[model samples]
Target: MLDDIDFKDYKKKDDIHGTVLYPAVMVAPVQKKILKDIISKNKIVSIFDPFHGSGTALYEAFEISPEIHLVGCDINPLANLITRVKLQGVSQFIFRDIKKIEDYIKKPDGIYEYSFPNIKKWFRPDITDSLALLRTAIMDITSDRNRLYFWYILLDVIRFNSNTRSSTYKLHIKENDKIESMQNTVIDMFLSAAKMNVNKFKHKSDNFILYKNDIFDIIKHFRKNTFDISITSPPYGENATTVPYGQFSMLSLYTIPEYDLELEGWELDNYSIIDNRSMGGSEKSISLTDFELSLIKDYLSLISIRKQKKVIRYFKDYFYFLRELCRVTKKYVVLTLGNRTVDRIEINLVEITKKFLEKNGYKNISSVMRNIPRKRTPRVTSNVYQKPVNSMNYEYVLIYEKNNVTPDREFS
Candidate 1:
């Protein structure tokens, strides 16, 4: 570990390459600083992120402490793939393989042959053919790491080459005129992205361990007190109508054959599966009285009956997630949450999270409200009770330290 180096002095070297990897609400740089500050207070030997998202938290952690054992879990395969690539570090073998793929792109052997449902709707015919060719070439690579690296490149290609508008999370195709003006080809985009990533990832490490499974399923595998620090930003609002993470990633996820939803027990096939399985995605009901945040109850009463259930269900999942986090985290957990609106009523998620954590044997150290810089999420305008409502502009970072007096319980 670079104990002599000042972690606070370090700054991001490549923001563009980092943000383009995946589209989820990223933990802001300031929030990362808050997490690092908390980590600095303790002897941090291991780090965990239950919702890895684009793996930015772990990436920052590794940058601060290269030898720290890092573990992350995310339900999205694309997230898992991106996290693994980021943590595993780029190798010379992968770079050489990327070079070979680049050379082959100059003189392709056969016509593109891959197809999937709704594929043409998202991609122009020519663009589809080029992407298929790129996919085949990437697959031909012998190394798994190299294949994943190229696959990551393809993800960027799909997003740029697709007919979908860049601003919206939902998969809405651009107007015909906009589509006609788009001149970038899949191969060109893929090669450019690959080159940029290769240049950025010249240095590699092997300290990270990632899992492509649900947080609940994967948390069971970890023993008690396995992590020194945990930092993450869980999904906010109703997954279906709010932030459709799975839907946003459909174009990229469809390209990976292992994500076939038709396969038994394949949950990823459903486009909204990630959001549907997210914090508030379930249909089960919970008593409003069970929650300590009266503001949540007030918001529930203000929103439509249907949305009320979603709010309650989300907290239910949120509560369970906190319990698991409390069980595994040995010292501290940093949670960054946004205060979204339900029927124009501000739901202070940080306050609710604070209550939940304190109840689960965690001592709340502090809650810092931070302005969201460069918010990537498009402003959501939804009809609640036939009136328009918008999400909040700021988020809060809640720092919680595990109460040493309380013993860790086995997560059921």
Candidate 2:
């Protein structure tokens, strides 16, 4: 383990990741530092991130190790697209592609290109019309790679124009008066953003592979010991409770052409489908009450039985994922975790993860705490009482090394 250190020394602004917005992006320089250290200690060939939100870790790894194989996945199609575009890099003729966007807008279809429940509530009519026009133009792009970069830029445009308040991650609409006053600047926003974002991802590399499936499902196709290292920042808590990544992304997912995304088992009929499929969100997964951790028992004892169920369900899913993640990874695992609030109490995820990894024949090597720098997530407000509070003040990056022995029971 390295000596106690401050992340402030290694800090550098993200050039590529900032081109598009994503919730809870791992710090790029720190991720690079971790990957660089791992590569120096061992001969690194490939890296994996199951929860590759916006591809922060993979992007940094790519910057350092251009030849290293990169693999990552996220349930959100928008995330998949963002990371894919980042790894593939934008074409050199990105400006020419922007000029071509005008060609696709032959004539307005006079109707929205897609539909979902209460779509009108989230988007003003004029805004919808302009977006549809832009969507058509993006679709007209002949090359899939160029089309993807345009789509990546459009995600921010869609979110900003939507009636949903950009101040928070949850899908709460702005006041009616505010919505009515909004302008139809979709075309302008898309054009300016496309030009601005095109240059951020111009370093082309094709060795990386990104998946858009649940981590467990994606692991099934992989043989044991496939990746040399795994670097990921899993969600701090259940999606509904913390950041509703699915709900926050609903507008973009629905707006982007389904054919382009090539999504699997994603039903747009309900907005909460992605969040519900998230960890601890499924009904069947929630009913598993046999969590065999003393840390869990001690923590649950302090909270009400009602809230205990939530904690139990989330960890059941988390522990299951941890086992599978360790099984597939060969040498090292670096997890950046956060302790989030549950019923006004902090859940010690850092300690919990250390203990859990130990059960799977692993030992902690490095643990460092870093204050979140320029975080986009606002001071979290409770939906129940409309109260805002400081949250997720810091994050812990825990590094673990796998022991040689394979077989051990997971719990006491």
Best by TM-score: 2
| Off by more than 4 A, model 2 | 1-14, 103-113, 284-291, 376-380, 383-390, 404-412
| Ten contiguous residues minimizing lDDT sum, candidate 1 | 1-10
Candidate 2 C-alpha lDDT tens digits along 1-412: 4454355654333477777778887878778877877776677889999999889899888888899999998888878888998888777777777887865565544444766679899999888888888888888777788888888889989988999987878889899999988876788888887877666777787898888887767776787888888899998778987778888888988888888884885646588888888777764432333444665787887777887887888887788778788888887889999898776677899988888888777877788887775665755645423545557878899888778633222211
Candidate 2 TM-score over all chains jointly: 0.90
* Candidate 2, run of 10 with poorest lDDT: 403-412
Look at candidate 1 and give me any clashing residue pairs: none
lDDT of each: 0.72, 0.79
* Residues 269-340 of candidate 1: C-alpha lDDT, one tens digit per residue: 566776676657765453434555463676677778876777778877676677778889998888878878
- Cα displacement (angstroms), candidate 1, residue 237, comes to 1.9
